[model samples]
Target: MVIKKVSIIGLGALGILFGHQLAKKMPRADLRIIADQNRIQRYQQNGVFCNGECCDFNYVTPEEPCEPADLLIMAVKFNGLKDAIQSVQKHVGENTIILSLLNGITSEEIIGEIYGMDKILYSVAQGMDAVKVGNQLTYDHMGMICFGESETGLISERVNVVTEFFEQMEVPYKVDSDMLTRLWGKFMLNVGVNQTVAVFESNYGEVQQEGPARSKMISAMKEVISLSEKAGVQLTEEDLDYWLGVLGTLSPDGKPSMAQDVEAKRISEVELFSGTVVKLGKRFGVPTPINQELYHRIKLIENRYTMIG
Candidate 1:
């Protein structure tokens, strides 16, 4: 499709990271930040800062009259996906390729149910330490985005076009042949690192250390490995070790999105991570006690913001 016009639905860490990178390459009018009126106003006023540099993006609302984007990126949290889907309705054309940078594994399926599977490209953002606080996002490493066709292994036209676009934008990416395994690997990493850090109110440094926190993190990830086996998309200790290595490269103080959510007193994506694990564990007859506990602990953290003393 050549990807001339691009629209992004979220301004989270990953969103800003890619948006900022694309903005540097593409014309300002070619890349659109799709948001409602309220969010547009807020973004215009507060401005988006990536690594202390302000981003000047073309902001468009759902109701605005414009041509559909060639590429649409959905980076909203799980809780906000519904609204994001609706907000980007005016921006989706027949040939538009959609990529979901959400943490969990179900976002593609959820998006595809409405947008058709043909338009959806499975994607995962890995090895990034970007953390967003307020309107500012800072990252030590710009992670590579892994994406491919829905079924994986075949580089389709859409995949090639997206790859070209990413190349032009100088954004790091990997065209994965086995996208499902990569997605599950990322899910396992989130199930371990995100939930564990959020629960303990610690940073990457704590889990990187050899201690109870690290042990608990590995235990939680082990549950995902078990469930993956039952689901026919198995991840091994090697994958776990690989992710641990990625975690090691991240800045010690960098907190994941879930940990940032807890610190900001915002709702986290526990339902997508450990919640998904626990649900699937039941279906697969895999005991996911670690994820179950992590799920409860994260929920408890969320409840603390609203629960009466």
Candidate 2:
């Protein structure tokens, strides 16, 4: 399929970043966003901010689900997948490809439950720190997006074409054969940075600079990795090298998504991030004490925040 129009279902940090870049590069490609009606109305009536870099654009919510797009990029919370997909699936064309930029290993399966395995792609983004603040969406990391065939192996040409298009747009991207390995690598990152940093109420930089906090981050990642191996997802030495290297290079000021969620007092995908490992520890008959403890502590903190809200 010769991609033309691309619709992003979420207008949060990553969504706005991609849309801004896509609009700039693919000028001909119709870039539509599926946002909350209120946010959409605000942006349509008054331009939305890309984290202080505001843009005046025509954005509209579907009144009653019309047609699907050539490509659909999903960027909602993991728990909100079904609602997010339902909102935009009607606009997804028969040949549409659903690319999930969310955290965790179950995105493809979530979409596959409805769209089938052939239409889904599991993707991971590094160095991307996109989030919503009021009417503005900010992405300080300017990261890269990597995606490939899930289990279906049906969209080689389409994947390549989309990846090339991303590259042309100055989005750092790569395609790998072991997509699951890539996913687990990120899962480790989320377990470490997203959860631990959120618990610290600090950004990536603060955590790294704080001696005790950084130690905690390392412990959390190691535990998550152990949980992954127990679940039969073998992570190699090279994987450790790449991820550890990434840890050293991460933006000092960047905060993990979980931290942001906690600050915002929004329901997080903790269950998918750390909680997944805890559940898997049971499934694989291996105990993940560190992860389990973090999961419990983080849940308590999250609950406290929610109750406060």
- Candidate 1 per-residue C-alpha lDDT over 160-189 given as tens digits, one digit per residue, 9 for 90 to 100: 999998988899999998899989999999
Q: TM-scores, in order shown?
A: 0.97, 0.90
* lDDT score of residue 117 within candidate 1: 92
lDDT of 2 by residue, 77-175 (tens): 788788887777566667888888888888878887888777776788776766666666776667778888754334488788787667667767877
lDDT of 1 at 252: 89
RMSD after CA superposition, every candidate: 1.2, 2.5
**Stretches > 4 Å off in candidate 1:** none
Instruction: Please report, in order, the local distance difference test score of every candidate based on alpha carbons.
Output: 0.91, 0.75
lDDT value for model 1: 0.91
Pairs clashing within candidate 2: 67-91, 68-90, 68-91, 68-92, 69-91, 69-92, 205-252
